[model samples]
Target: MSPTFTMSAGRPAPLGATFDGDGVNFAVFSEHARRMVVCLFSDDGKDEIARLDLPERDGDVWHGYISGLRPGQKYGLRAHGPYRPDEGHRFNPHKLLIDPYAKRLTGHPVWNDALMGYRADSSRADLTFDTRDSAPFMPRCVVEDPAFSWGEDIAPRTPAKDTIVYEAHVKGLTWTHPGVDAPGTFLGLASDAMLEHYTKLGITAVELLPAQAFLNDRFLVDRGLTNYWGYQTLGFFAPEPRYLDRGRIAEFQQMVARLHTAGIEVLMDVVYNHTGEGNEMGPTLAFRGLDNASYYRLMPDPRYYVNDTGTGNTVNVDHPMVLRMIMDSLRYWVEVMHVDGFRFDLCSTLGRVGEGGFDRGAAFFDAIRQDPVLTQVKLIAEPWDIGPGGYQLGAFPPPFMEWNDRFRDTVRRFWRNDPGTAPGLADRLTGSATQFDHSGRPATASVNLLTAHDGFTLQDVVSYDRKHNEANGEDGMDGHGENFSHNLGVEGPTDDVSILRARAQRKRNMMATLLLSQGTPMILAGDELGNTQKGNNNAYCQDNEISWIDWSQADDAFLDFTRRMIAFRKAHPILRQKLFLHSRERAIDGLEDLFWRRTDGQPMSSSDWEDPALSCLCVELRTASGTPLYGATETAIFAVFNAGEAERITLPEVPEGMRWVWEVDTTRPDALPGACCGATVQMPADAVAVFVTEVQP
Candidate 1:
């Protein structure tokens, strides 16, 4: 420690440790804290060098300034308050806590009984507090110098209508790649191989699984498994240490800058609804030790936490300082980290209020909506939790796109030839009009996807009828019970050539449905390569080969198909529209903006939609109704979706000097353009054929 180091009262405006040229200022929020002490650690972050009590308190914030302290200093906080569990106050000064606003973490928490404030084996369970120094077991927080040279970096700002999201994990995407020098790290994600793949696949943004600092739960450690998905977030502003090469924050910045250079935006999957700390018996981490009742939503007993998120404890987002903390973290990512967007995990829990309630006008929603920085970036919501009224599909307000599970289930049942699915498929193919047409939201309000990280892969969806999760150590009981899957004929891996061919075509049909639909399309990272978890839908704890993308087993044909489909979607403006299509007529063109039909080429009757035996659907898409003259176009598109046997389809009539050009045929992936279509055509079984109108030059 510097002999000239001296402490004095500091400003409490900024809530984290800030480094100035001459010194560092530290501030933390703890409403019930009697005293807040900043402990300076040795250069190795092992031994304590200095301990100084904060000399100032403004409202709930305690602050102090240490002169001659450099930017490379390492420190941790200790809060002193009453340890009354029944009244929701659990503070132990012996347990070191990480700052809620920490932008850089030294490492993860080392698992130990001393880390917990309450004895795990105690019969009284949290009613009794233990006194043990935990600084040796906890990772120290560092004072970071947030300086970077982002030369000529710029966000792509891709519109929601044209955006295609690729959901990936930092480790899974590159850990098995042959070209990445630093596997399972942020530098690997920015490798030339990864950037080239994203560009080739027409991906506009990469939605990464949680990249924030997280804890590997003690229970998971005891089970010999790991939290591979990183949902147990510990530090919001800091990048996950495992993803960085040398524990420097610049690696994350380098990744963002390089992705921007390739015209790709970055989206983070964030979990703000819960924390790593479990219920009453959980460890005394940052929030629990600083001010328990103010940070978490406690139950009536004030000892147990509200488990609305299915995680142990729900964050008290309704509290003003807690809400401010979340908002500040979000803004930091946008302003400092330069991330393009966020996909909130279990977002419904963020809106929970008193007495089993959910409000659309909640303060969290209103705050983000009004913030200038947040409104500009993309915001996707998972839209559900385990709490009351938690299934809030189509419930979020404007500027937020939601994950639409209805699209996934409906499309799966439709392609599986399930009865009574035609109408539901029609509704989904047209952007789920019944669910998203209200509140002045656009068709892009629903993010349509056939598969995601939590469910079966695209290949597994057609290859496994039941979830095989015995490998998860849960006795086949952890994942979803009903996956809406089909095995075609045989289960798991099969040598039958007939079953293999059917599975391939089935995969194409579903991917085609997703690309041609009128909404944002998100592809699971390795689905294009036919990646499988051996039918384990819940591989959240498997960080081994089961979760990693095996590049050696790449399915070239499916990869080619994915690339072509994304290009096809980008080429057609009529498919990606901001307005929803009703059967209403356009005033200027005197034609219906959208039309549906059966295999007979005639307009579909109400009975056709209700027909259990109906095996196909046809649609003609045009510029949406009420589109201004500037938004209208001359091109029109026609498509056929056949899930059953071969059939003949009549074409929609074309205007004078106009011809329908054969654009796509899933059965013949090598099919070329400029093939003129006739009035009638023979469509293959279980295939999609798309045509675009061109001038008859």
Candidate 2:
């Protein structure tokens, strides 16, 4: 009766909602569903266009082909089965839902009570179903043509070791920059001038914050703010419509192409762990309303969802059909969107299994490993979540890089004047081999960061002791308590020269540690320019000037200093290493390439390391063997860190036949200066000195 054609149900080989341009083909793989129907929505979403009952049923797949439809059509699904909460089944057909295979989403969902599958005010949620058509409030899936011509533009293909990543939010990066006319949007980022900024900064890749279609929570919108961070993703495949300058979805793809031509790789921070559809009491925008049981991993009792990500709903990554949907979206980005890599937000959720534990051999992990296209691209993992055993820092398998929290904490503490932090500081400066050694990964496996979008900028890390998130409207309860941060002397801004000097030196010391460390360092946007969120670590809700990068506010001095620091790191080899170091082995001859010494030019004693007042350490590195670590070649360098007040540091004696030359000094008279060699360099207090010692010919 609903204009259905008789076609044999195809094999369940290619899974997910796939459209072939002729008509919409609905296919869902649920080994236990009793019935699955495809629901169509009108343009206004007030009336149901049609409900085509899936007549054909294969082994575990329910699919049917229908004609008289083209790309850009909107539809959803309603799978009905046993409503047994105790058995982990929550099949409700009353709430209209989204097709998991949707290639593109039309717009963001309108938050309302009608979008909820269960009565909002009721005590019992899944027990009593609310017979409401949620189509009016939910976003619709658009049939995409999946065709684009990317003429001559290929991924930058920069290897892991050679690549320098710049982590930035699309809107936040260029939002307040006066040069960018269209501030706080996608077009601003794609502009040629913005690309030039990165090119001049010497960053090879731009890891953008989530650009996927996301939701601004009802509470956030009501408070006159929104989820400015974009971590709470709603649709994996669709770009956020608000980000697009033009209505065409292809504009997002075009941005990637433009970046590629400039030799800059584009990596997306994706959230597959959770969706905007919150809990049983939350709205049913897409997956929840269509087939709650099949799309989500409900608790053994169906009334509740297992909140692993702390975002209300956890996607069933272990589900075969749902698993394929994620993989398909990933491939689409690489093949269709032309993205170079992905940084998985709360990646631990993707590795979860039956007992609600993270399984290394989860279906999602295996799928990515096996996919030829995906395997070739860069895959980075945030590597942890709120769930049990979620802190899988260096536990990820090969071809994966993880954020090193230990490195971040240690570096922060050492530079913050914390007592007895020397030993731990050295380990982190060498790339935290203790965490990543056994994983058979290179030194670059650890993606070191002193600051990211979730925390304070490098400038704030040395100027704020506590989070000032009152602006976020969370009563200052949001963000992490243990930030491992320290304000030099004053809690916030200060006119005291002593406090200001301490903050500047702390910044220099931390930057030196990050750049000199043997790993891939990801510099947060605006960090080099001394950007601050006014101590607001969790500015996820502040979409105003607080979150935007004020390019105009950046001084010439800060810009020059940042450029020199980046250039100095790129010019050295001892900083980046492919293999972890062996403490016993001499790097060249009888003398070790790396020598641990005190500020007195003597071998460091255990007691010296234990001293809380010990304010300085020397790291001497020799790369004379011309050994190559990734793309960086050989060079000898020495770094000295003084975290104390203005005091002349007794310079360590240069090795025989080698003269120490100052490559960079944090307290230089000018922001950018030439290297000075073979002199008693007046080391400024609370400053970092990088001296290059080359072999005399």
Candidate 3:
């Protein structure tokens, strides 16, 4: 019995060192590199045992076979190529590179200038490259024999029309929960208590913020603030070690298993558009030190990076190897991590072509469309970036859902008492059919959201008119300037009872609008409990109590109201139709499929939308077939919204075999009024009411 496993050169078909029980196969994809060497490291990561040169080249892929290497063996890649930056080739032999297709990673990277292929203090910067090997500082990839017994776990495959997304942070979600102690980390996100909370919330899916292994910005770390949002991703294949338990992948798998068992889907917000390496002045972390020209989009002169993502360097998706890396990363998350979907950040960057125009048939899009496993899962796109022609919201092909920023902005303005917003609000309520109808995409193609992770919470929107980002240390300039929010008379905290009542009403109106809209709605984590960032719209840097979900601060009344509103949405079939109503000539009772009526029950004329003080309006929605479900005939629910001083509006004529029942009165407690008429539906100033007419025999 030999202490060391037998070692020999083997054939390379699959990239990265593949270790079968019999032998090990080595493969690396470096098109321009003259020679590639596989570096073996000991347990301590300080000593390098061997550097075997790979001499076989089949096409652009470099492959060689070695027998006797075990699965637990740690390794890295050292590619030999030219270090020319002007020609877009910044490959340095001195710096050890990670395999783009690595499966398992051991640890996290500790920032140091030694990790850079170029000297930090040198005035010449990347031009005057350093020759130090970075294997000591960087995390090495491990070759593990992939094996798992997924006894009965399966992707719930919740239909898009029925999906209710809850955008949450894996760490922030479970960290503060008193019951979820040991497993609040990434591995612990699927604890029984936490899963039960999500299941109870009635959310079909959880869209977690970026969980890809990331590093805190050096500047932010110097200021004692970390990138808590995890938007700065470094490793796509490996989960961040900070979220893991004892540097194991099993923790992540366990979380997925539990969530699946609980009938909830997981969607990862992936940031592949940019890397953590900030700018040209930033450290040479991975891509820059490995192959800067091939991995990133450099300017024509080659000194600066193409800042399309608004995050320093934009990835060069046009390159085959870079595109392959993204595809591999996505597959890893789906097959290994058991994620149900991915919400691509700045997805437009992934479809860019050489002509500087967005390409619908780009290799990346084509690959995902054709990939059997990926095509089956949900695909969501942020749909825009800061680059030229970046706002490609409706451009994604069928089967891909996009974050409808139009839906967000329009809803914000309308609820904030903005003038003449009825036209825009109508489009948003209809799932932005104008934008999505042409792509063979149903209404579900528009992921309607009023609030997301980047902006103000639902509570802050009704409380603050301007962003209060002074705590971010950026002197209030870090967040967005133009916030479409109304203070409801006084800004921030107020003791006035009227102001408190108005704030509560506004929150309900916003939530109800989102839930009742045609598309899939995503509620920001703490919004349901009236969470606030103290009016700070951007809390990316605030990892303290300011960003945490305060479970103790929940108002009992508001929580109960939220439960009722969510239940109302799930219970109603007309609110979530997959198809858009044709606008041509159909009107129920001479009213359109959806009609805007004034307080007097008269059809809202075009001029009525221009009324500034006109705070109240009613919307009547009906299904296309004049019936919502097979058993139930179509019933129009008139949602009366009173943004002005409360006034009791007379109820419309109750149809035959139907009596209106007070469903949800935003001003009152969770009480269902027994009598339909003569009930005097008291709508407090700045409140909304949902009066339902269930057909009676």
Candidate 4:
């Protein structure tokens, strides 16, 4: 490397390598580093041209300014300090590290032993230091121009009551798309074909599986697989390199603009709980090398890290700098990249501080709740981790939606005709009022999901009783065991028409139930087209055909059904409401906001709820009693959920000038509406039916 480049003391206001026309200002935080140098590379990013040490330090931050450097300059950092893994200070100057605020990277790291800070094979693992130069094996951060002409790109701020979230993986969604020109790239997802599909599907928002740059596990690579789901985040500010058609951040910006133009919001799944660098034995890529003790939550011994996320190391959100990094990353996505919101992965770890359990008042949550930029955008939490007391489904504060696992399990168990599920089903249908009703949080606070990437698809939920994850190379012990799913007649795939029909019906029932409930419904990407993983619930390691969406073999009927169902939900205001229905009588029409009934047309009693043989539940719904006059525009609605044998049930009576009209029937997809009910309606076995009030005049 050339030593000709000179450095001057620079201001340490905005961290990261900032190129401001004349040169670049380099600033990084390293509390224990003796010195830090910026290693500049050639245009091709292969040859090291110059190495200059940052000449000043404002508090804990190291800073320097280099003249005559341009926006496209490629560089890496090296911090000089003690390499004591026992005391939690692993500052190795030989291991090239990425800047924590790096907006773009040259490429992915070439996996090698030099990338590690210590000799992992030593008897005292991670205690022995290695002096291997790691610049040739690590990826370099590139100076970003930060200039994009976003001409008239307006964000589609779809209201929470009208949002239908479609969860999809960026590559898996576009890889096998027949109409996509550049498959498996961001541009492909924003292509005309994909946009048309999104608009036609009637989804207001698309919740993307992590688009952030991530690491492919070394062990998974050895077994001929990769980290396809991308939960292991390596760089928070950069987009995934594999998802780009050309090596540029502009491609990601263009994708966001296209989705916004189509009137669809984009929500990213973010992993801030932990990093790709696993444990003490893991590689020294970025954070572990920059400031190990300051960046991570170390254990009492200070040698090991707190593994609350089950991903080897939990981030120290309690630290002010660490919390600032997270907040800055989120704002960058919202302001610079034009993304709508984020769905935090393993969010329980972020809401916790030190040894205290998950708290809504934690620094991380408080920072986001009070931030001007972040409060305007949507924030969703995965709501749980492997840490103690981590299952915080409805415990999050107002304006922060949480992924309701209880909703998922309850819906599955109820549809499978499990005994004693009627009461649970009733609670879920009303947005689980017992859990989310307090703290002034609305019903939309619960992001109700029937299936996500972590578990089975809607088709597999009705076809496989247990998970089939043998292809993941973890021997069948990788995914969750109790799926609460039921295979009607046979396990795995079967051509039996009877079983196939039942499975399709079960899928429709769950899908209908989800749309009819009073929460934000999230549909797994291929559930509409009946995409199947062949019962593989956990396909995080399978990047090939096992995970990609097969467009050619799409279930046109079911897809049409899903589209119609979403449209139906949008058409009915009673289905998706902001307030919980508590059976209080409305002043405008003397009708109860919610009423539970039995087959005899009488209100449900305590004895009826306790009956184990009771498999049917009917509900009467209207606008909340406390709702203002402007919001009480909708009429009454009656729905029946029958899981037992088919029977005739009496429908609830309407007002003087209104009559009950058949609206939706999940048992018959092709069935037409506008059938005025008689004294009784035939409640189909294991099916759902909805009726709305109509004027007789």
Candidate 5:
């Protein structure tokens, strides 16, 4: 039996449940609540043991200290306030709410009618209140010890210029991984075999999809689907219990520590834009039950929510308490969880103030810029939303890398031989300087990616002309229509050798373009091994074989090509320069830093860039002297991409006593550096070739 203890008023400085050796102090913020109660539960989280009303009220914060409470104790909160949906005060003392700062959570929320704050079949909808108890269906927040022996765990802090981000879904990356001890879990993802794979792949960081505690939508559950991507966040500070092998939060810490030991940083895909509670008609599981008006941005009438995230509701980050909670959650992930950085999902919503627009000087951005810890970490933004003025691709401030969809489309169009795409491809190849060059930001600010989690894989990009989302259960109406993909004369997989060879070559061509571009490159996890989702561009609902990576089908040749490309990019610093490359000569040797050329070894004229039918181009990079860049001296690289038919192309002029060596040729089976080539090279149709200049010492 647990020991009985007296309850005392606790300080409200540090919010959430804080355990300090002897006892536990619980503090929660609810500005409109008339009363607050902390409900303590048993270890199994099924039985409620005690319920104590907070004795102290420091302004809008309710706080209390319990002397006998230990670290393993499970608890939840219930606030008493008006149940007026029209007024935006959705407080119900009967419903158990999750702590916004919960470090750990136990049990999965069981779907039931009691979980809903309002009646399901009632015509009055949110205006009508349900009095049934929701504690049985809700997950309990656990008071974590927060004590872990992280001996000598150091962050890799890989420089943005040299960083290669591998965006992966924790479960999807390892669910079908052969010979793993615990597949589809944090421990499985941090296994030695996985770490070795990442090391050999030459990626500096793993950008994981959302690992925060999240909810499986009832609609998805009813439709026999699951929220595999985990965008519907429930608790920010807590790791998703489903991903834990033993349901212990320490497993997450161990995963981070192990990844750090392997010299690979961990970047979480966080969703601070909105919560899983959703609109007024949605369930009041946590935030909506605690304080709806303060946590969510409501309409002028306060009945409906502002759906800026296209998810049903938007987080009111303009609110002081809500903003503080977000900041605290970010710090917890960095300080306690030891994550190196974050990639904000639907980030535009976080930078929007009340009634105005997405402002760069919003409180959320200002707070992050001024933060002592967050400012030092790598910050990446999705930089768009469904709200008004949402497509702010290159509008993010310094230290933030925005995902460049323009690069994805341009590269795709260029390889597909689309007309009038040469100029756009040129801009993307040099790092989209027109977009990210301002505000003292370098080329690294443009996170150039060909395909991300929401799109088709590299293999599918070359194999499927349209999205095949029939398995998603939405009558194939979902997913993007204009994927900028080409089927190469076949819709799906085929045994025809010609089509197969063409698709493979196209895949290699795009991969080469992505890796050789002058910006921070992000590779989709299974793209290196030629993983395909059978044309399901939006596999957010297909959690089966369509989403899980199949290690059995790993393509060795494609993997080798990817590995070599990454190694080549790292070896040649000219490809990953911090500053944008210009066409002027900065070296004493009179070699230009960067320049575009035609197939005939002549500099590209203004008319060439403007030509609508132009389907071929060459980019040359050489050593410069203006300010010493990252690479060695006396180095030069020439890359030729041909989207047209096979033709004889004259190689560009090399420096004083240098000869061009074929480094990578997409048309060839192997991309290894071969013998020196002559002045003119035979370029294959729909392929890319790379040559490096070596001086005769």
Candidate 6:
């Protein structure tokens, strides 16, 4: 016989299963639910021991406390109400639901017809309610003891200007690594071997794709694939169980601690815009079962959901209860999980207010800005969605950095020798001041990235012109068709010496541009070591070797060059300045902060900027009294780009008592240390070179 427990009235202020010294308090919010029942399972979570009705109703919240109930107890909820889809009420007590604020979950949902509230084979479809018990098919929410000895675990708190984000997926990053003892797990990512690699890469933070618990799509499962990118969130508070091999939530905390110990901040890529529940016809998971109208943005017709994220139902962040849940989840990650920051995925949807319009002064933004703990953490926004007015780049409020896609496109077109890209490239290299310079937002507000997880890797950018996403189970029509890539000569990997050499040089040029550019730089993991997805730009479902980082194929020379480039950026504070250069002299020094020039070493004129044929240009960064914009005095550097045919760039005149020394050249196999140049320098086609001035003391 299962152990029975007595209950008492619980407070509804603190939602979810909160464990006190005596027992656990269970609370959930469902304004439209007529009845709510909490089901307790056996220790193994297979047998339902008892069912108790939440007798207390404080406003929209139903809550109750169970004495003698401790941590490790498995439970779920069942709400009975109207199942009218047209009226936007999808409550069905037969379908068990996980707690919206579940700190930990016991199992992954086994896909079955019983898990759905609507009958799959019915002619009426979602209108037909199925009374099958989904308890056996669903995961049980665990009443967890939120206590861990986070000894000396402090946030790294890396400065925004100093942060170099390395985007990585936990499992894909270390699953195939030969050095890691615990592969495909959080412990493996925190292993000494992985930490050493990140340290060597010179990235201050690791922006993990998504760690929140998500559901596996039935389509992918049928095709022998999985959702490799954890964008489909199930439980916002629970860490994905697959990532924890042994220690569960404690293992995730340990990972954070280990990363912090290594001086690297952990920034999670969070998806609060939507849940895994696809559409009205989709599975009745936690949110849809508990309260569909309040949890999801319903259409005026009330039968369909507002699909803002392009993934079925958009989250109704405008609702008070939903907003509270999101805020609570974010705080939980920062305070309990010890994460340093968050990168909001498809963030435009979160800022949408009533009437389904994006608002700059949205309540979500205000809540974060007003929060004491959240305001201190680094906040980044993906800044776009597929909805109306969703392409909101550089429009976020203060302290919220946005991923600048214009920078990526401009850089790609410039290197590809596309006409009229020089001016755009110049703007991007200087932090895209056109987009982010307003509202007193600094240059750091633009997170400049040449490539990210959603697109092609640096290697594939020069190796394949078209996306080969056949492996994704979708025909060639899946990923972005306009990848802004070039195949050099051959389509895929070729042993041709000329093509290989050209591709390597192009990769180096792109990497140099990304690192040397102003604003925060984000390096896609495995890009420095020349990791490729073979032409599979969108490998969201290919969770095998197609997505894993192949350490054996690591390019040591390229990795060294990348490391040196990062070091160079760090050495020169001007490269990563917080302020956007306005071509004005600094207060400390009388020299102009930055200068844009044509290949002839003259300042770019209006006609030059408007010229469609111009492809090559030069940028000069100067120091005032040997001091950069932010840090201590550093050497002034001049960088030149030659995307056209090979040309001789007349080196700009150096300051008095100083000479130009070549520091970096993309044409060479490695960074070259050359003698002082007098006037002119030779640059190969589609290459970039850097020269720093030496002061004669």
Query: What RMSD value applies to candidate 2?
Result: 3.1
Query: What residue runs in model 2 are displaced by over 4 Å at the alpha carbon?
Result: 1-17, 41-47, 356-359, 495-498, 586-591, 624-634, 645-658, 669-676, 679-682, 695-697
Q: TM-score of the candidate numbered 3?
A: 0.93
Off by over 4 Å in 5: 1-5, 585-591, 626-634
Cα shift from native, residue 416, model 3 (Å)? 1.8
Clashes of 6: 0
* Model 3, residue 256: C-alpha shift (Å): 1.3
The 10-residue segment with the lowest total lDDT in model 2: 626-635
Clashes of each: 0, 4, 4, 0, 1, 0
Worst 10 residues of 6 by lDDT: 625-634
Local accuracy by lDDT, each model: 0.89, 0.77, 0.78, 0.89, 0.89, 0.88
> What TM-score does candidate 2 reach?
0.92
Alpha-carbon lDDT of model 5: 0.89
Candidate 2: tens digits of C-alpha lDDT, residues 1-697: 3444433454354554566766656677666678888776665555677787787778777887766566766777787776565565556777666666666777777777777666777887656667776666777777677677888887889877667889998888887777775656677787878888888888889998999888889889888998888987877878887787765677778788889999999999999888887887677666664556777878766778988899888998877777877888899889889999999999998988876677778888888888899999989999899999989988887778898888888888877777877788778877788888875788888999999999888888988999888898888888989888899678988999988777776777787677778888899999888888999998888888888887776745666666667777777656776777555564445445566766656778888878888777677666635343334422466677776655443445655665656777777726454454644455666678877764555
TM per prediction: 0.97, 0.92, 0.93, 0.97, 0.97, 0.97
Q: Which digits, one per residue and each the tens of the lDDT, describe model 1 over residues 39-150?
A: 8998899898888899999999999999778876889999999999999999899999999888888988988988889877789868877888989889888899888898
- On residues 236-352, what C-alpha lDDT tens digit does candidate 6 reach at each position? 999898888973788888889999999999999999999999998789879998999999999999889999899999999989999999999999999998998999999999999
Q: What would the per-residue lDDT of candidate 5 be over residues 1-697, giving only the tens digit for each residue?
A: 2346567998896899999988999899988988988999987888988888889999889999998689888999988999998898888887899998888888567789888888887997789888999999999999988888999999999999999999999999998888776888899999988999999999999999999999998888989999999999999999998889997888999999999999999999999999988788888788998889999999998999999998899999999999999999999999988999999999888988888888988999999999999988999999899999988988888778999999999999999999999889888989998898798899999999999999899989988999999888899888999999999998989998999899889989999999999999999999998899999999998889999989999989999989999998998888998978878754445656887988888899999888999998888886566333443333778888889998788887766677888888998857457568899999889988888877655
Higher-ranked by lDDT: 2 or 3: 3
Between candidates 2 and 5, name the one with more favorable lDDT.
Answer: 5
Mark the 10 consecutive residues where model 5 has the least summed lDDT: 625-634
Model 2 residue 273 CA deviation in Å: 1.9
